[model samples]
Target: MKRLLVLSLSLLALCAAAALASAPASLLTPDLALERLQRGNERFVSGKMIHPNQDAFRRTTTAKEGQKPFATILGCADSRVPLEVVFDTGVGDLFVVRVAGNVTYFDQAGTIEYGAEHLGANLLVVLGHTRCGAVTAVVKGDHVEGNIPALVANIVPPVEKVKSENPGMDAAALTNKAIEANTWQSIEDLYKQSPIMREMVKAGKVKVVGAIYDVDSGKVNWLGEHPKQQELLALTGGAK
Candidate 1:
């Protein structure tokens, strides 16, 4: 047990070192990173995108210097929501993980940990969309084929919660509310599943926020941190 603990600590230190070695000269704080993403989304929404960091020079520079993305996004795999294009960012600007429903399972949480802990990204965004098919399926309890049920299993609880809480809501309203609830559920799953992310967040090294992308308006509606962020952080049982 002692040897295993030492090896785990050693690996963590090595990962931290690699991250620091490749980190940008000026690392953006969590708030600043969030602001940058908001500004980029504004440009995208207004059709005034400057297309930052897409140029050959920027690509070559990032390739040489190594990628140091400022924000890590966990978004839905909806074809309509192109994360970089929606955010108006370019090469090496954002580290992204996409899965249907934007659900945070063990693998998703671990990948998010890599992006935030091992890649030095302080801002973590869970980007769901306004009308997500995966969410819709879960909301309606649609019959799914092989493997798909497993994919959207995590969404069931949130959808059920929404239904139980909003018994008077119509189908459309229930679906809409469930979508938002699922986003929060993903954050909860992250805090529950990934100790790495929980510690980083508790240590003030990472911030996890949620957002919803509107496919029609091309705008990202930011939802800030979870309402019970402090409670979530407290689960880490460590210092900030």
Candidate 2:
């Protein structure tokens, strides 16, 4: 009986150690999580995909257990901008939210909050891209003349604000500016509008970031590290 007890205790200790080792380092700092993402993106842009999801057997095993995606991406419904390919992330690595123009309504905000507060996601990324048709429509004041008007209406306010602030800015510039503004607005909405996300941010449990993907170059410009509010404002117009 004494030998059996010793063996059981030893087995339990080994299991605990293995669990601690397997737990990701991002659980401690959001910066570490960001670093991981940057590295993955770099690999993607360099034509060196890590192919983290290729192991079907391992994926099935993990599926049977559970998932713990590290980051959540709120992005546009554009077919050209695929979240996983651009970021070089695998199936279980990211929780993604997609909508036309990347607009966040009450339900979308709740979904993002759940990813962070309940799904154990440590970071949130609002990703926008250039040459966006939705933004173009809003800039040109071209509502689709149907139920799509509501969607266009949601994207118009930020472009209008940008034009009002910089009266001399042209249509193309305004649309480009609004695409970023809309992205930052989504970032703000994720934090200011969602109670659960706000609490997580306040407690340092999660970090909210903004980014823009240049469709021409396939490069991801991280907005979180922008040095000044003016620069960020110039970039996204949600600088304050």
Candidate 3:
């Protein structure tokens, strides 16, 4: 047991060293912030989490100086998908918004805009997760009660899209496809509906990418950036 613990510590140190060895310039660009999160998750999945920025010092510093999170995460409210733990970020490193299925809506867009436009988040991640209850509910057409039903409705379009595309695809495969579809659609909703976010994307100040967290494996699979977002980010200066 003691040897195992020591080995864990050694592995943690190695992951931290690798992350720091080629650190990018100050999380200023969306690509750089994405890379930072990718490295952090690598440490997490390898069981080598440094648990960076979660210390008393970090807590105190964030409290005293206010938050300046480098990334904004729109993730599911699933307890299993604890945003900070999955990304291995800590106090003030991530501005997170959680709702079932990680769907984008008006209020959610406002919150994300505040994070990016005001808080200076260069990276925006629309994170869906595997075996997501919300997507499952929609796929199964469950009779969920109350406002929960409305919440599940948010994920239905993606299911329909997946169904239309895949025809007689199996249930498990359909759910997976729906989750990916939902992730990409949320990214599109954010970029399309929010003029503030659109301007930010055009300026290259923010990049919105889609990802899905593998619930069973504790790994986040980055599904690449949105295409319109790609075109927007490629343009320099002003929102045309």
Among these predicted structures, which one has the highest lDDT?
Answer: 1
Residue-by-residue lDDT tens digits, candidate 2, 1-240: 999999999788656533432345346357766766776677678786555653786489568966677888888889988888887666677889998788777767888878887778888888888998888888887748776777656677778888898898877788788998888777655544566666666677888888988888788889892233233233322113
lDDT of 1 by residue, 128-157 (tens): 898899999988878999999999989999
Total residue pair clashes for candidate 3: 0
Q: Count backbone clashes in candidate 2.
A: 0
Ranking by TM-score: 1, 3, 2
Poorest 10 consecutive residues by lDDT, candidate 2: 231-240
Record all residue pairs in model 3 with backbone atoms less than 3 Å apart, i.e. clashing: none
Q: Is candidate 1 or candidate 3 better by TM-score?
A: 1
lDDT of each: 0.85, 0.74, 0.83
Tens-place lDDT digits, model 3, residues 95-116:
9999988998887899999999
Task: Kindly indicate the candidate among 1 and 2 with the higher TM-score.
Answer: 1
Which lDDT value does model 3 have at 4? 100
- Judging by lDDT, tell me the better candidate of 1 and 3: 1
Sorted by lDDT, highest first, which candidate order results? 1, 3, 2
TM-scores of all models?
A: 0.86, 0.79, 0.86
